[model samples]
Target: MTETTDYFDALATALLKGGMAEPAVSATLADLRGYLTETGTAAHEEFGPAGEFAARLAGGAPAGEPVAEAETWKWTADIYVDRKHLNAYGDQGWEVERIDRLGRFVSRRDPEAAMCWEYRREVTGIKDRTAMTEALAPEGWEVCGQWLYFQYFKRPKAASAGPAAVIETPPEAPGRRLFLSGGYRKQLVATLVAVVLCAALTAYAVGRGANVTAILIGAAVAAPIGGLLGWYAVKRDVLTGAKES
Candidate 1:
Protein backbone atom coordinates (compact mmCIF):
# COMPACT_ATOMS: atom_id res chain seq x y z
CA MET A 1 0.00 0.00 0.00
CA THR A 2 1.06 3.62 -0.57
CA GLU A 3 2.42 5.50 2.46
CA THR A 4 -0.53 7.88 2.52
CA THR A 5 -3.07 5.03 2.33
CA ASP A 6 -1.26 3.12 5.06
CA TYR A 7 -1.15 6.18 7.29
CA PHE A 8 -4.87 6.81 6.77
CA ASP A 9 -5.77 3.17 7.47
CA ALA A 10 -3.72 3.21 10.66
CA LEU A 11 -5.37 6.46 11.75
CA ALA A 12 -8.82 5.02 11.05
CA THR A 13 -8.04 1.87 13.01
CA ALA A 14 -6.76 3.94 15.90
CA LEU A 15 -9.91 6.06 15.84
CA LEU A 16 -12.05 2.92 15.94
CA LYS A 17 -10.14 1.43 18.86
CA GLY A 18 -9.75 4.68 20.85
CA GLY A 19 -12.05 4.94 23.88
CA MET A 20 -13.08 8.57 23.27
CA ALA A 21 -16.80 9.38 23.20
CA GLU A 22 -18.37 8.78 19.76
CA PRO A 23 -18.90 12.43 18.90
CA ALA A 24 -15.37 13.40 19.90
CA VAL A 25 -13.92 10.48 17.93
CA SER A 26 -15.94 11.40 14.85
CA ALA A 27 -14.89 15.06 14.97
CA THR A 28 -11.26 14.19 15.59
CA LEU A 29 -11.28 11.77 12.66
CA ALA A 30 -12.87 14.39 10.41
CA ASP A 31 -10.21 16.92 11.38
CA LEU A 32 -7.40 14.43 10.78
CA ARG A 33 -8.84 13.51 7.38
CA GLY A 34 -9.04 17.16 6.37
CA TYR A 35 -5.47 17.79 7.50
CA LEU A 36 -4.20 14.76 5.62
CA THR A 37 -5.99 15.85 2.43
CA GLU A 38 -4.49 19.33 2.63
CA THR A 39 -1.04 17.98 3.41
CA GLY A 40 -1.19 15.52 0.50
CA THR A 41 -2.27 18.20 -1.94
CA ALA A 42 0.55 20.50 -0.83
CA ALA A 43 3.11 17.71 -1.02
CA HIS A 44 1.98 16.69 -4.51
CA GLU A 45 2.26 20.25 -5.77
CA GLU A 46 5.70 20.80 -4.27
CA PHE A 47 7.18 17.42 -5.17
CA GLY A 48 5.73 17.26 -8.70
CA PRO A 49 5.08 13.48 -8.41
CA ALA A 50 5.90 11.12 -5.55
CA GLY A 51 6.96 8.28 -7.85
CA GLU A 52 9.25 10.52 -9.92
CA PHE A 53 10.89 11.98 -6.83
CA ALA A 54 11.45 8.53 -5.34
CA ALA A 55 12.98 7.19 -8.58
CA ARG A 56 15.35 10.15 -8.91
CA LEU A 57 16.50 9.94 -5.31
CA ALA A 58 16.94 6.17 -5.50
CA GLY A 59 19.28 6.47 -8.47
CA GLY A 60 21.83 8.46 -6.37
CA ALA A 61 21.57 11.60 -8.49
CA PRO A 62 22.67 15.09 -7.38
CA ALA A 63 21.37 15.91 -3.89
CA GLY A 64 20.72 19.62 -4.53
CA GLU A 65 17.20 19.20 -5.92
CA PRO A 66 16.19 16.73 -3.15
CA VAL A 67 17.64 19.05 -0.49
CA ALA A 68 15.41 21.87 -1.71
CA GLU A 69 12.44 19.49 -1.66
CA ALA A 70 13.29 18.52 1.93
CA GLU A 71 13.07 22.20 2.96
CA THR A 72 9.65 22.49 1.31
CA TRP A 73 8.51 19.35 3.10
CA LYS A 74 9.59 20.77 6.45
CA TRP A 75 7.81 24.06 5.80
CA THR A 76 4.53 22.32 5.02
CA ALA A 77 4.82 19.81 7.86
CA ASP A 78 5.09 22.46 10.60
CA ILE A 79 1.66 23.16 12.13
CA TYR A 80 0.98 26.08 14.47
CA VAL A 81 -2.12 26.74 16.57
CA ASP A 82 -3.13 30.40 16.85
CA ARG A 83 -3.67 31.70 20.40
CA LYS A 84 -5.47 34.97 19.59
CA HIS A 85 -8.80 33.77 20.99
CA LEU A 86 -7.19 33.32 24.40
CA ASN A 87 -6.63 37.08 24.53
CA ALA A 88 -10.32 37.76 23.85
CA TYR A 89 -11.35 35.69 26.84
CA GLY A 90 -8.60 37.25 28.94
CA ASP A 91 -10.12 40.71 28.40
CA GLN A 92 -13.33 39.50 30.09
CA GLY A 93 -11.47 38.53 33.31
CA TRP A 94 -11.68 34.90 32.23
CA GLU A 95 -8.33 33.24 32.77
CA VAL A 96 -7.64 31.12 29.72
CA GLU A 97 -5.34 28.12 29.73
CA ARG A 98 -4.53 26.17 26.59
CA ILE A 99 -2.24 23.18 26.40
CA ASP A 100 -0.79 22.33 23.03
CA ARG A 101 -0.26 18.77 21.81
CA LEU A 102 3.13 18.87 23.52
CA GLY A 103 1.55 19.83 26.85
CA ARG A 104 2.81 23.41 26.80
CA PHE A 105 0.34 25.77 28.45
CA VAL A 106 -0.65 29.23 27.17
CA SER A 107 -2.53 31.39 29.63
CA ARG A 108 -3.64 34.99 30.08
CA ARG A 109 -4.96 37.27 32.85
CA ASP A 110 -7.32 40.25 32.82
CA PRO A 111 -6.16 43.92 32.65
CA GLU A 112 -2.45 43.17 32.91
CA ALA A 113 -1.01 42.05 29.55
CA ALA A 114 2.53 42.96 30.58
CA MET A 115 2.35 40.61 33.56
CA CYS A 116 1.51 37.76 31.14
CA TRP A 117 4.08 35.01 30.78
CA GLU A 118 4.90 32.28 28.27
CA TYR A 119 6.61 29.61 30.36
CA ARG A 120 9.17 27.65 28.37
CA ARG A 121 11.67 26.17 30.85
CA GLU A 122 10.57 22.65 29.99
CA VAL A 123 9.41 23.36 26.44
CA THR A 124 11.39 23.05 23.23
CA GLY A 125 11.90 25.77 20.59
CA ILE A 126 12.88 29.38 21.39
CA LYS A 127 16.55 29.11 22.26
CA ASP A 128 16.33 32.28 24.39
CA ARG A 129 13.16 32.29 26.40
CA THR A 130 14.14 35.42 28.30
CA ALA A 131 14.64 37.45 25.12
CA MET A 132 11.44 36.07 23.67
CA THR A 133 9.57 37.02 26.83
CA GLU A 134 11.09 40.51 26.83
CA ALA A 135 10.08 41.04 23.19
CA LEU A 136 6.52 39.89 23.83
CA ALA A 137 6.28 41.97 27.02
CA PRO A 138 5.60 45.06 24.93
CA GLU A 139 2.56 43.30 23.51
CA GLY A 140 1.25 42.35 27.00
CA TRP A 141 2.57 38.75 26.97
CA GLU A 142 5.32 36.93 28.88
CA VAL A 143 6.76 33.51 29.75
CA CYS A 144 7.11 32.09 33.24
CA GLY A 145 7.29 28.91 35.38
CA GLN A 146 8.64 25.49 34.35
CA TRP A 147 5.39 24.46 32.71
CA LEU A 148 5.84 26.61 29.56
CA TYR A 149 2.82 28.95 29.75
CA PHE A 150 2.18 32.08 27.64
CA GLN A 151 0.00 34.63 29.42
CA TYR A 152 -1.47 38.02 28.63
CA PHE A 153 -4.29 40.45 29.56
CA LYS A 154 -6.41 42.97 27.70
CA ARG A 155 -9.33 45.40 28.22
CA PRO A 156 -12.79 44.23 27.22
CA LYS A 157 -14.58 45.88 24.32
CA ALA A 158 -17.09 48.63 25.24
CA ALA A 159 -20.79 47.81 24.93
CA SER A 160 -22.53 49.46 21.97
CA ALA A 161 -25.74 51.54 22.36
CA GLY A 162 -28.38 50.21 19.90
CA PRO A 163 -30.29 46.95 20.09
CA ALA A 164 -28.25 43.82 19.39
CA ALA A 165 -28.60 42.45 15.85
CA VAL A 166 -30.87 39.44 15.46
CA ILE A 167 -28.85 36.48 14.25
CA GLU A 168 -30.78 34.24 11.82
CA THR A 169 -30.35 30.62 12.69
CA PRO A 170 -30.93 28.28 9.74
CA PRO A 171 -33.67 25.66 10.15
CA GLU A 172 -32.87 22.01 9.51
CA ALA A 173 -34.09 20.63 6.20
CA PRO A 174 -37.32 18.55 6.49
CA GLY A 175 -36.00 15.56 4.51
CA ARG A 176 -32.77 15.44 6.52
CA ARG A 177 -34.72 15.64 9.78
CA LEU A 178 -37.02 12.85 8.68
CA PHE A 179 -34.08 10.52 7.84
CA LEU A 180 -32.46 11.23 11.18
CA SER A 181 -35.66 10.79 13.18
CA GLY A 182 -36.84 7.56 11.47
CA GLY A 183 -33.92 5.32 12.40
CA TYR A 184 -36.01 2.67 14.13
CA ARG A 185 -38.60 2.75 11.35
CA LYS A 186 -35.95 2.30 8.68
CA GLN A 187 -34.35 -0.55 10.63
CA LEU A 188 -37.67 -2.35 11.02
CA VAL A 189 -38.45 -2.06 7.32
CA ALA A 190 -35.00 -3.42 6.41
CA THR A 191 -35.35 -6.34 8.83
CA LEU A 192 -38.73 -7.26 7.34
CA VAL A 193 -37.33 -7.15 3.82
CA ALA A 194 -34.45 -9.39 4.84
CA VAL A 195 -36.81 -11.89 6.42
CA VAL A 196 -39.01 -12.04 3.30
CA LEU A 197 -36.03 -12.50 0.98
CA CYS A 198 -34.56 -15.20 3.21
CA ALA A 199 -37.89 -17.02 3.29
CA ALA A 200 -38.16 -16.98 -0.49
CA LEU A 201 -34.59 -18.23 -0.93
CA THR A 202 -35.10 -20.97 1.66
CA ALA A 203 -38.31 -22.13 -0.12
CA TYR A 204 -36.49 -22.33 -3.43
CA ALA A 205 -33.71 -24.37 -1.86
CA VAL A 206 -36.26 -26.75 -0.26
CA GLY A 207 -38.08 -27.20 -3.56
CA ARG A 208 -34.80 -28.30 -5.18
CA GLY A 209 -34.31 -30.79 -2.29
CA ALA A 210 -30.78 -31.68 -3.46
CA ASN A 211 -28.55 -31.69 -0.37
CA VAL A 212 -29.44 -28.06 0.42
CA THR A 213 -29.03 -28.21 4.21
CA ALA A 214 -25.85 -26.16 4.10
CA ILE A 215 -27.53 -23.60 1.88
CA LEU A 216 -30.46 -23.39 4.25
CA ILE A 217 -28.16 -22.88 7.24
CA GLY A 218 -26.20 -20.24 5.33
CA ALA A 219 -29.33 -18.33 4.45
CA ALA A 220 -30.62 -18.60 8.01
CA VAL A 221 -27.40 -17.17 9.41
CA ALA A 222 -27.00 -14.52 6.68
CA ALA A 223 -30.56 -13.18 6.88
CA PRO A 224 -30.38 -11.93 10.45
CA ILE A 225 -26.77 -10.87 10.10
CA GLY A 226 -27.52 -8.78 7.02
CA GLY A 227 -30.59 -7.31 8.63
CA LEU A 228 -28.65 -6.37 11.75
CA LEU A 229 -25.90 -4.80 9.64
CA GLY A 230 -28.45 -2.75 7.69
CA TRP A 231 -30.05 -1.57 10.92
CA TYR A 232 -26.67 -0.61 12.30
CA ALA A 233 -25.89 1.44 9.18
CA VAL A 234 -29.13 3.38 9.43
CA LYS A 235 -28.75 3.94 13.17
CA ARG A 236 -25.17 5.09 12.78
CA ASP A 237 -26.13 7.52 10.03
CA VAL A 238 -28.85 9.03 12.17
CA LEU A 239 -26.57 9.30 15.19
CA THR A 240 -23.89 11.01 13.11
CA GLY A 241 -26.41 13.51 11.72
CA ALA A 242 -27.65 14.33 15.20
CA LYS A 243 -24.11 14.83 16.42
CA GLU A 244 -23.24 17.13 13.52
CA SER A 245 -26.37 19.20 14.05
Candidate 2:
Protein backbone atom coordinates (compact mmCIF):
# COMPACT_ATOMS: atom_id res chain seq x y z
CA MET A 1 0.00 0.00 0.00
CA THR A 2 1.06 3.61 -0.59
CA GLU A 3 2.24 5.64 2.43
CA THR A 4 -0.86 7.81 2.15
CA THR A 5 -3.17 4.78 2.19
CA ASP A 6 -1.25 3.24 5.09
CA TYR A 7 -1.59 6.44 7.11
CA PHE A 8 -5.32 6.68 6.44
CA ASP A 9 -5.87 3.06 7.38
CA ALA A 10 -4.18 3.61 10.71
CA LEU A 11 -5.97 6.92 11.24
CA ALA A 12 -9.33 5.34 10.48
CA THR A 13 -8.84 2.64 13.11
CA ALA A 14 -7.62 5.14 15.68
CA LEU A 15 -10.52 7.51 15.02
CA LEU A 16 -12.96 4.69 15.47
CA LYS A 17 -11.25 3.64 18.68
CA GLY A 18 -11.44 7.21 19.87
CA GLY A 19 -15.27 7.17 19.55
CA MET A 20 -15.71 8.84 16.17
CA ALA A 21 -18.68 7.36 14.25
CA GLU A 22 -17.96 5.41 11.06
CA PRO A 23 -19.51 8.01 8.74
CA ALA A 24 -17.50 10.83 10.32
CA VAL A 25 -14.31 8.75 10.00
CA SER A 26 -14.82 8.24 6.29
CA ALA A 27 -15.58 11.93 5.71
CA THR A 28 -12.51 12.99 7.70
CA LEU A 29 -10.26 10.67 5.70
CA ALA A 30 -11.65 11.94 2.39
CA ASP A 31 -11.06 15.54 3.46
CA LEU A 32 -7.55 14.72 4.62
CA ARG A 33 -6.77 13.01 1.32
CA GLY A 34 -7.79 16.13 -0.60
CA TYR A 35 -5.73 18.32 1.72
CA LEU A 36 -2.61 16.17 1.26
CA THR A 37 -3.05 16.14 -2.51
CA GLU A 38 -3.37 19.91 -2.68
CA THR A 39 -0.40 20.62 -0.44
CA GLY A 40 1.75 17.84 -1.96
CA THR A 41 2.68 16.68 1.50
CA ALA A 42 2.22 13.34 3.20
CA ALA A 43 -0.57 13.03 5.80
CA HIS A 44 1.78 11.99 8.61
CA GLU A 45 4.08 14.94 7.93
CA GLU A 46 1.40 17.59 8.33
CA PHE A 47 -0.66 16.09 11.16
CA GLY A 48 1.75 13.78 12.96
CA PRO A 49 1.03 10.13 13.86
CA ALA A 50 -2.48 8.80 13.22
CA GLY A 51 -3.16 7.73 16.82
CA GLU A 52 -2.12 11.10 18.25
CA PHE A 53 -4.04 13.17 15.72
CA ALA A 54 -7.19 11.13 16.34
CA ALA A 55 -6.81 11.60 20.09
CA ARG A 56 -6.55 15.40 19.67
CA LEU A 57 -9.67 15.51 17.55
CA ALA A 58 -11.53 13.31 20.00
CA GLY A 59 -10.42 15.28 23.03
CA GLY A 60 -11.89 18.47 21.63
CA ALA A 61 -15.34 16.93 21.29
CA PRO A 62 -16.18 14.93 24.40
CA ALA A 63 -19.60 13.27 24.52
CA GLY A 64 -21.52 14.49 27.50
CA GLU A 65 -22.26 17.60 29.53
CA PRO A 66 -22.89 21.15 28.31
CA VAL A 67 -20.07 23.59 29.07
CA ALA A 68 -20.53 26.60 31.29
CA GLU A 69 -20.30 30.12 29.90
CA ALA A 70 -16.69 31.24 29.81
CA GLU A 71 -15.26 33.86 32.13
CA THR A 72 -13.31 36.59 30.37
CA TRP A 73 -10.51 38.92 31.45
CA LYS A 74 -8.45 41.61 29.76
CA TRP A 75 -4.95 42.59 30.77
CA THR A 76 -1.62 43.71 29.33
CA ALA A 77 2.08 43.78 30.07
CA ASP A 78 5.17 45.38 28.64
CA ILE A 79 7.39 43.35 26.32
CA TYR A 80 9.64 42.37 29.20
CA VAL A 81 6.86 40.67 31.16
CA ASP A 82 4.41 39.55 28.48
CA ARG A 83 5.66 36.01 27.96
CA LYS A 84 5.98 35.33 31.67
CA HIS A 85 2.43 36.47 32.36
CA LEU A 86 0.99 34.82 29.26
CA ASN A 87 2.25 31.35 30.15
CA ALA A 88 1.23 31.78 33.77
CA TYR A 89 -2.36 32.60 32.87
CA GLY A 90 -2.44 29.93 30.17
CA ASP A 91 -1.54 27.27 32.70
CA GLN A 92 -4.66 28.30 34.60
CA GLY A 93 -6.74 27.53 31.50
CA TRP A 94 -7.00 31.08 30.15
CA GLU A 95 -6.98 31.12 26.38
CA VAL A 96 -6.05 34.44 24.81
CA GLU A 97 -8.55 35.36 22.09
CA ARG A 98 -6.82 38.44 20.75
CA ILE A 99 -4.92 41.55 21.65
CA ASP A 100 -7.45 44.37 21.61
CA ARG A 101 -7.15 48.02 20.44
CA LEU A 102 -5.60 49.13 23.73
CA GLY A 103 -3.03 46.31 23.50
CA ARG A 104 -4.70 44.25 26.19
CA PHE A 105 -4.92 40.44 26.05
CA VAL A 106 -8.56 39.39 25.87
CA SER A 107 -8.88 35.90 27.33
CA ARG A 108 -11.52 33.39 28.37
CA ARG A 109 -11.85 30.21 30.42
CA ASP A 110 -14.79 27.90 30.73
CA PRO A 111 -15.22 27.02 34.37
CA GLU A 112 -16.76 23.64 33.71
CA ALA A 113 -14.32 22.54 31.04
CA ALA A 114 -11.03 24.23 30.20
CA MET A 115 -7.87 23.10 28.53
CA CYS A 116 -4.44 24.23 29.59
CA TRP A 117 -2.82 26.42 26.93
CA GLU A 118 0.80 27.08 26.08
CA TYR A 119 2.10 30.24 24.46
CA ARG A 120 5.31 31.61 23.02
CA ARG A 121 6.31 34.99 21.67
CA GLU A 122 8.28 35.44 18.45
CA VAL A 123 10.11 38.50 17.20
CA THR A 124 10.29 38.70 13.43
CA GLY A 125 9.66 41.03 10.50
CA ILE A 126 6.33 41.17 8.67
CA LYS A 127 7.47 39.15 5.66
CA ASP A 128 8.85 36.29 7.74
CA ARG A 129 5.80 36.04 10.03
CA THR A 130 3.77 34.22 7.39
CA ALA A 131 6.46 31.61 6.99
CA MET A 132 6.72 31.36 10.77
CA THR A 133 3.00 30.78 11.09
CA GLU A 134 3.04 28.04 8.45
CA ALA A 135 5.95 26.34 10.17
CA LEU A 136 4.20 26.38 13.53
CA ALA A 137 0.77 25.18 12.32
CA PRO A 138 1.92 21.60 11.80
CA GLU A 139 2.81 21.57 15.48
CA GLY A 140 -0.75 22.75 16.35
CA TRP A 141 0.01 26.40 17.09
CA GLU A 142 -2.36 29.17 16.04
CA VAL A 143 -1.57 32.88 15.95
CA CYS A 144 -2.81 34.63 19.11
CA GLY A 145 -1.84 38.20 18.16
CA GLN A 146 0.76 40.55 16.71
CA TRP A 147 2.03 43.92 17.92
CA LEU A 148 4.67 45.68 15.86
CA TYR A 149 7.42 43.09 15.35
CA PHE A 150 6.17 40.71 18.05
CA GLN A 151 4.06 37.64 17.26
CA TYR A 152 2.36 35.36 19.78
CA PHE A 153 1.25 31.78 19.19
CA LYS A 154 -0.86 29.42 21.32
CA ARG A 155 -1.90 25.78 21.38
CA PRO A 156 -3.79 23.59 23.80
CA LYS A 157 -1.34 21.52 25.82
CA ALA A 158 -3.51 18.53 24.98
CA ALA A 159 -2.15 18.47 21.44
CA SER A 160 1.14 17.22 22.82
CA ALA A 161 0.28 15.95 26.27
CA GLY A 162 -3.12 14.38 25.69
CA PRO A 163 -4.99 13.83 29.02
CA ALA A 164 -2.05 15.08 31.05
CA ALA A 165 -2.74 18.65 29.95
CA VAL A 166 -5.24 19.39 32.72
CA ILE A 167 -3.85 21.63 35.44
CA GLU A 168 -4.20 20.88 39.12
CA THR A 169 -4.02 23.62 41.75
CA PRO A 170 -3.84 26.47 39.25
CA PRO A 171 -2.02 29.61 40.30
CA GLU A 172 -3.84 32.65 41.64
CA ALA A 173 -4.97 35.33 39.20
CA PRO A 174 -2.57 38.24 38.78
CA GLY A 175 -3.67 41.22 40.87
CA ARG A 176 -1.66 44.01 39.32
CA ARG A 177 -3.21 45.33 36.10
CA LEU A 178 0.04 46.05 34.33
CA PHE A 179 3.46 44.40 34.39
CA LEU A 180 6.29 46.78 33.50
CA SER A 181 9.95 46.03 33.88
CA GLY A 182 12.19 48.43 35.79
CA GLY A 183 13.70 49.57 32.53
CA TYR A 184 10.29 50.36 31.04
CA ARG A 185 9.40 52.36 34.15
CA LYS A 186 12.61 54.33 33.78
CA GLN A 187 11.77 55.03 30.16
CA LEU A 188 8.34 56.31 31.15
CA VAL A 189 9.79 58.61 33.78
CA ALA A 190 12.32 59.97 31.33
CA THR A 191 9.67 60.61 28.70
CA LEU A 192 7.43 62.33 31.25
CA VAL A 193 10.24 64.55 32.47
CA ALA A 194 11.00 65.61 28.94
CA VAL A 195 7.38 66.46 28.22
CA VAL A 196 7.11 68.57 31.38
CA LEU A 197 10.34 70.36 30.62
CA CYS A 198 9.22 71.15 27.11
CA ALA A 199 5.88 72.45 28.30
CA ALA A 200 7.49 74.70 30.90
CA LEU A 201 9.94 76.11 28.34
CA THR A 202 7.16 76.72 25.84
CA ALA A 203 5.10 78.52 28.47
CA TYR A 204 8.08 80.57 29.62
CA ALA A 205 8.89 81.59 26.04
CA VAL A 206 5.31 82.76 25.41
CA GLY A 207 5.30 84.81 28.63
CA ARG A 208 8.53 86.55 27.53
CA GLY A 209 7.06 87.21 24.05
CA ALA A 210 9.65 84.90 22.44
CA ASN A 211 9.32 84.11 18.71
CA VAL A 212 7.29 81.05 17.55
CA THR A 213 10.36 79.49 15.87
CA ALA A 214 12.31 79.67 19.12
CA ILE A 215 9.53 77.82 20.97
CA LEU A 216 9.44 75.13 18.26
CA ILE A 217 13.21 74.67 18.57
CA GLY A 218 12.96 74.29 22.35
CA ALA A 219 10.18 71.72 21.98
CA ALA A 220 12.03 69.69 19.39
CA VAL A 221 15.26 69.67 21.39
CA ALA A 222 13.51 68.66 24.63
CA ALA A 223 11.49 65.91 22.92
CA PRO A 224 14.55 64.02 21.70
CA ILE A 225 16.29 64.46 24.99
CA GLY A 226 13.53 62.43 26.64
CA GLY A 227 13.52 59.97 23.70
CA LEU A 228 17.23 59.44 24.03
CA LEU A 229 16.97 58.76 27.73
CA GLY A 230 14.14 56.30 27.11
CA TRP A 231 16.19 54.58 24.43
CA TYR A 232 19.12 54.32 26.80
CA ALA A 233 16.91 52.72 29.47
CA VAL A 234 15.63 50.03 27.11
CA LYS A 235 19.04 49.34 25.61
CA ARG A 236 20.61 48.90 29.03
CA ASP A 237 17.89 46.48 30.08
CA VAL A 238 18.28 44.41 26.88
CA LEU A 239 22.04 44.26 27.37
CA THR A 240 21.67 43.14 30.97
CA GLY A 241 19.28 40.38 29.96
CA ALA A 242 21.63 39.20 27.23
CA LYS A 243 24.53 39.07 29.66
CA GLU A 244 22.59 37.11 32.25
CA SER A 245 21.34 34.60 29.68
lDDT (10s digit) by residue, model 1, range 42-140: 434433344443332222223222211110000000011123323322232333232323332223222222122221121233355456556656655
Q: lDDT: which candidate is best?
A: 2
Q: How does model 1 score by TM-score?
A: 0.24
List where candidate 2 sits over 4 angstroms from the true fold: 1-66, 159-162, 168-176, 201-212, 221-245
Clashes of each: 11, 0
**Global lDDT for candidate 2?**
0.73
Each model's lDDT: 0.37, 0.73
Task: Rate residue 60 of model 1 by lDDT.
Answer: 21
State candidate 2's TM-score: 0.60
Candidate 2 lDDT over residue span 75-128, tens digit each = 898877778889888988888866655677867676656779999887768789
Instruction: Superpose all Cα atoms of candidate 2 onto the true structure and report the RMSD in Å to 1 decimal.
Output: 11.2
Leading candidate by TM-score: 2
